[model samples]
Target: MTGTETLERPETADKVEHFDVIIVGAGISGIGSAYHLQEQCPDKSFLVLEKFDSFGGTWHMHKYPGVRSDSDLFTFGYRFKPWMSAPIATADEILKYMGEVIDDNDLAPHIRYSHKIEHAAWSSKDKKWTVDVVRLDTGEKRRFTTNFLWMCQGYYNQEQGYTPEWDGMDKYKGQIVHPQTWPEDLDYKGKKVVLIGSGATAATVVPAMADDTEHLTMVQRSPTYFFPGQNANELADLLRAVEVDPMIIHDIVRRVALFQQQEINRRSVEEPEIVKQELLEGVRAFVGPDFDMDKHLTPKYRPWQQRLAFVPDGDLFKCITDGKVSIETDTIECFTETGLKLSSGKEIEADIIITATGFNLSVLGNIPFEVDGKPVNWPETVTYRGMMFTGVPNLLWVFGYFRASWTLRVDLLGDYVCRLLKHMDEMGVKQVTPTIPDSLSDMKVGNWIQEEDFNPNYLVRSMHVMPKAGNHPDWQHTQDYWREKDEIPALDLDTEALVYS
Candidate 1:
């Protein structure tokens, strides 16, 4: 057996282990945390515990056909690693990229895969966290303690998939599938498929399935705003000509892409109607006037209020125009043995049903956590700077925003955490937590975004947190690259908002 396999197949559990910091969830955030931590605190004993056998978190778990990043690779990719391949990367490619990152950084030894964290509790007297974990394969339970606990655990559990309750769903004779936990061996060729919901997943899957499936119908409760993916050939060509180190190329491309995205966002904010018109016109041109654009195309909310679905080269609209795909905007009244029954008294038949209904916003996964033996209610605890939660000592959470690439925000948070850890070490502080000022009220804190059709759990929780702009210019929430570089480095680590002891 390989040395790695030997270690993984341990005969007995190592019940008592210690670390300077314990990071949960080995996804992008967690891996990023490890990368930063290793650089900042080389001497510190740190461990990354992932529930799954492999890395790549979300990218690894989601294996549906046509699964790829909605955001362009340049900005969506890690700051340290440049996206040298396609501007829009596929799931498998992204996963491979993640694996390379882990290998390059020598992060394998730090990670213990299949080690699912069950619970974590803080000991006020010990000034440390006692974390309980389980080995899924062996059903072995063990405990470990750490000076700091970092939750890199992403906001969703792929296993606890979301399935909306539609009447008569149980009666359906055909195979029902949720894209989150898609079946491997299911065949779609020559099958009439009905895809439920109108989100990113649905938008992506419909076009992909259209080529093989006899006919694909998208059932929508409400319409989602659509935007064409701008994988700029000009930018791609420029990067190709001036090919430098992959790392440098990645950084340059990331900056350029960030600028482009910011420009789009700026135009949308300044000229909402014009931006809306352009988007609608683009969709109309692709889908053709034969399709009812007014009924099925328009969204209830303004652009960027919720994420606009990205269709690469109008792939989704192309499929629709070619008669391979169709969209139904009526409310799903119930499910039937043959297909879905709409409130309009129309029944559409399908041999297979795919529920791209949406995801459960696991702001924090169901893993139980306590501070000083008191149960911590996540909703009740205010988020600090939208990254860390107030009242939770020595803990940090990284979450992305609706307006920018998730990795951009996550990179910044990772840097900030590294800086914070360094600052804490210098001051010999054992614990740190945000102190939410009494003056800060819900009235002062406005929602960053709102959409009737989009899921609100994560956004709502994040809105109440102090904005980077209001707190300090460095912590201020501009997604611009130059501004972030200038401000983030200059952030006052000893800000009054943070309590150190």
Candidate 2:
């Protein structure tokens, strides 16, 4: 910070860096956009503006002890790049993979690190968007113009994590930390550690720190669905052993994984008993028959009501069986001098506390957007294919499927944007917007999330900030991958749904 404040900056404060298309992030989505831009639109000039000093958005931000993907790499990894390592990859591996992609694709020249896009204004007369960019160093501001704006910035607040105010939190003398902003130097070796919350983060941290800490405890208000999966995928290993090309292996393995995910998701809702018994039996095998699974594993709601947390090779259960970890399924009444006290009068002693709570969802990078001098009201607008917003011309936001792998939809989006630009060029059109009929105008505005029954805590907290959806499919955002897969690619550009200018 001192060096930043004192050094002379290179990016001129008032200079504008223009491009044909301007992407707002350098995470997985943004990088994929760049790759597709190179592959599909070779002549188009573009720039990727990253807010952080480096790439790997979520992976780079959360540097806690156990930071790995809940979903395996078969689908989470890009279809273009076959993930050949362990099916479940660590944060470091993902970061390295991203860097390799950028290097191999010669995308480093197009990236502007430490550049944040703040606001954008569109002019109908100019038929172009004027954007404001801010440099994190020296607080310099600049302006740029683009014919199209691709919002690849991810859907959560990067700077902060959601931590509810617990009673008597100030009295705890030990160090308290949040996983979003973990300190590199904070040591937990041989120290008692208690992680609060039963979400994916807490599940990940318990097993990761079990061997390092003197004792590890997971505190949860209620139980969440846990799915124990094999760490190594034999299918991938066998495919590689038989000398199948990695890309072909990726194609087959990705589909197999997706189909498996879809089948499990279906049964979780339709045949809950089958999934419940299968999952609990895996736990019971490790924890023994005498263990009280009703208190620690059973949830009142059905499976997939919230996200199903995954632990590879049953690592979390291994920790519990090894006597290195314990569970507290109760509410925290208050924080004592050293640890938290439950409402049931149960006390947990800890030297360090990690709040693996959740995230504050963000829509469109929290940027102020204006078209022809009028502010964009998202809730008043309807979404098109969960990507483009009605009345917003040539602006597409890459929001992937919630239940499926995020990259699956984003890969489609990158190609779709390229195709859209080409189609506009062919038709001599400069702008396009989704148009809804007057009959749908007065339709009841409901939550964008149709499956409210599958409510996660983070989505419940931040759904208000997102756009609304009506009853129609064209007006609503569907979370089904198969439906979107068949429908989006075959969409007609000349249809009445899109108005060209």
Could you tell me every candidate's TM-score relative to the true structure? 0.90, 0.95
Model 2 spans with C-alpha error above 4 angstroms? 1-12
Residues 1-501, model 1: lDDT tens digits: 111221121233566798999988888778878888887778889999999898888888887889988877777777877677767778988888788889998999999989987777777778898888888878998788998888887876568567778899889999998898888898999999999988888888998899999999999877888887554546656757876566766766677777777777777778878888888988988987777887898876667666778888889988988999999998989999999999999999999999887776565666667787576666555556556666788888776655667777667877787788888889988888777555543324333233342334334544443222233322223334445656666778787778888
Tens-place lDDT digits, model 2, residues 162-203: 888999899999999888989999999999999998878887
For candidate 2, which ten residues in a row score worst on lDDT? 1-10
- Return the TM-score for candidate 1, rounded to 2 decimals: 0.90
Best by TM-score: 2
The lDDT for every candidate, in the order shown, is 0.76, 0.85
